[model samples]
Target: MSTREEILGAAQRRLNLDPTSSMADIAAAAGIGRATLHRHFSGREDLLTEIGARSLDRWEERLDAARVGDVCSSDDADRLRATLVTLLGQYLEDSDDFGFALTDQFVLAEPTLTARGEALAEREIELFAAAQAAGVLRDDVSPRWISQACYGLLVAARDALRAGDVPRRDLDTVVASFFLHGAAAPGKPL
Candidate 1:
């Protein structure tokens, strides 16, 4: 891997473990000297800004892969297609760093991170609106609220997996199921 990629990877891991970790700490974690780290990234904030941007960019890609524009076709069918399930499953499998940055107090407090969160929310709102218009999702609840709740569920499932409360293999299933059906049991009255 390139030095920059190595530093970002190491930063993601270290920041996830402790958002308050210093640049020196991250350098040590990355097995590089402070000067080398600084050469790649100006400082802690600069590195964090990049991390937040990269994670958000990844999620945007995932959202596109989920095919938000396919709401019409999905609603024309009786059930949601596998594309959504597959996309969400990938989110659960690969969004650990994204989740980590999102849940971190320090990261969330960053202005750039907050802006990224807003953009993410807007993207989700668009997706939800498309689905709701097609009758694939309920329109009674605000899309923004539902999106937030769904994300909360994803993060919760991620934490459960991290805490060993649930197996990693089950994380995707749990998140995807909750996103599609919420807490309603099969054949149970909602």
Candidate 2:
């Protein structure tokens, strides 16, 4: 891999483990000198912006692969559920690649990242709204709430995996099921 790519990968892993890591810490983690790291990225914010952009690209690709937009607009419950499973599965499989963007405050605060993230989230909210209108999702809760809840679930899943509270193999299934069905047991009162 190229040095830039290597540094980005190493930095991402390091940040995932600790969001408060310094640029020097990232340089050390990347196995490069501070000067070399600076040559590639102007500073920590620059590196984080790059990572955040890449993360958004990955998420957009997954959304497209799952054909989420198409499924959301349809009135078919089966398709909606299936698409959600596919989307969640892909996200879980790619957790390591995009986890940092969701958790890193600096990345989220970047102007470019904020704009791109809000755009993506707007699409997601529309998707949920369509699903709600189609009877695939509950109508009581707002679509915006569902979108935000889904994001929260993903963050929770990442934390759970890091904490070893959820098995790696079951991460996708656990998250998909929880999002679709909630924590209630069958025939059990809420």
Candidate 3:
């Protein structure tokens, strides 16, 4: 691969392994000298900002490809369950950078994020509203809350994986199940 691609791939691996990995750590993993790494990335912040943008861009692309906007074609619950499993899979895969992207620094750096973020929020709200209308989802919370809760829970799950407490293979099933049914005993909703 090219030097930039090699560095980014190595850096992402380092970050996922340890979010606080140092530039020296990444350079070592990338198999490049510190000077070469610096020749490509002026500083750690510059590398991080670029990776955050790349992560956000990839995130948007994956969600867009999931076609969540047209998710009303079937039984809402079944479709939502399938959709979320796919989404959470992507979310977990990007655990390395998703946390940073949600931070203030990355949020402030990308002006386009606001518009895309608003659109995503609105789309999620619409889906939640539809599912609720279909009598699948509970009406206790607003669509906004449902969307935010899923994101919050996903982040928590990602952190748990980082801590080595959760098994990687079970992440998708566990996350999907929790989103579809949280704290509910068997067939009962709590």
Candidate 4:
């Protein structure tokens, strides 16, 4: 990788461990001097913007690779559920600096970044709507609601993984069950 890429990679790794980490921390992690880090990234905001863009790119690539249309055609609900599991898994496994910064409060607060996030979210909702129209997903649930629920599942799973409360291997099944069926006990109306 180029020096800039290496620095970005290092910064991203530190962000994963602690989103609030300073430039000094990133420099140390990257094994470079602070001046060198600054040469590549003039400031924290500059670095974060790059990371945010990169993260969005990675998400787009993953979404494309999933071939969502094929799965949706086979079984819309299952496809939607599987797509979410895949996304969460990608977030958990990604080593890019942008992925790490995704957990940061500042990143979430940035209007541009948040807008990009929302656009990605809307894509997921479209997928849900496709499933709903196919009758695999409950017609009573709105695409917006299901999209929010899907995001909630990802956040909860991430927190659970960080807390060591849930095993990583169980994430896919857990998320799938919740989205496909829901948490209400059997015989109870949803």
What TM-score would you give candidate 1 relative to the actual structure?
0.82
Clashing pairs in 4: 12-97
lDDT of 3 by residue, 1-190 (tens): 3479878878876766666778999898898888998999998878877776676677678667878677755546778656766777887777545554554354546656656667666766776786776777888888789888887877778777778777988887787788878867897745
In order of appearance, the predictions have TM-scores of 0.82, 0.92, 0.76, 0.81
lDDT of 4 by residue, 120-165 (tens): 7776677677777767678796889976776666667667777887
Highest TM-score among the candidates is held by which one?
2
Q: Comparing 1 and 4 by TM-score, which wins?
A: 1
Return the candidate ranking by TM-score, descending.
Answer: 2, 1, 4, 3
Q: Lowest lDDT 10-mer window, candidate 1?
A: 72-81
Per-residue accuracy of model 1 over 1-190 as CA lDDT, tens digit each: 3479888998899877777889999999999889999899988878888888887788878767766556434564333445446656776766576667767666678887788778877876776665676666788998888777777877887678778987887777777777878787789976
List CA RMSD, all candidates: 2.8, 1.7, 3.3, 3.1
Best candidate according to lDDT: 2
Off by over 4 Å in 1: 70-83, 184-190
Q: State the lDDT at 55 in candidate 3.
A: 67
lDDT of 4 at 26: 86
**Candidate 4 lDDT (Cα, 0 to 1):** 0.72
Worst 10 residues of 4 by lDDT: 91-100
* lDDT ranking, high to low: 2, 1, 3, 4
Error of 2 at 21 (Å): 1.5
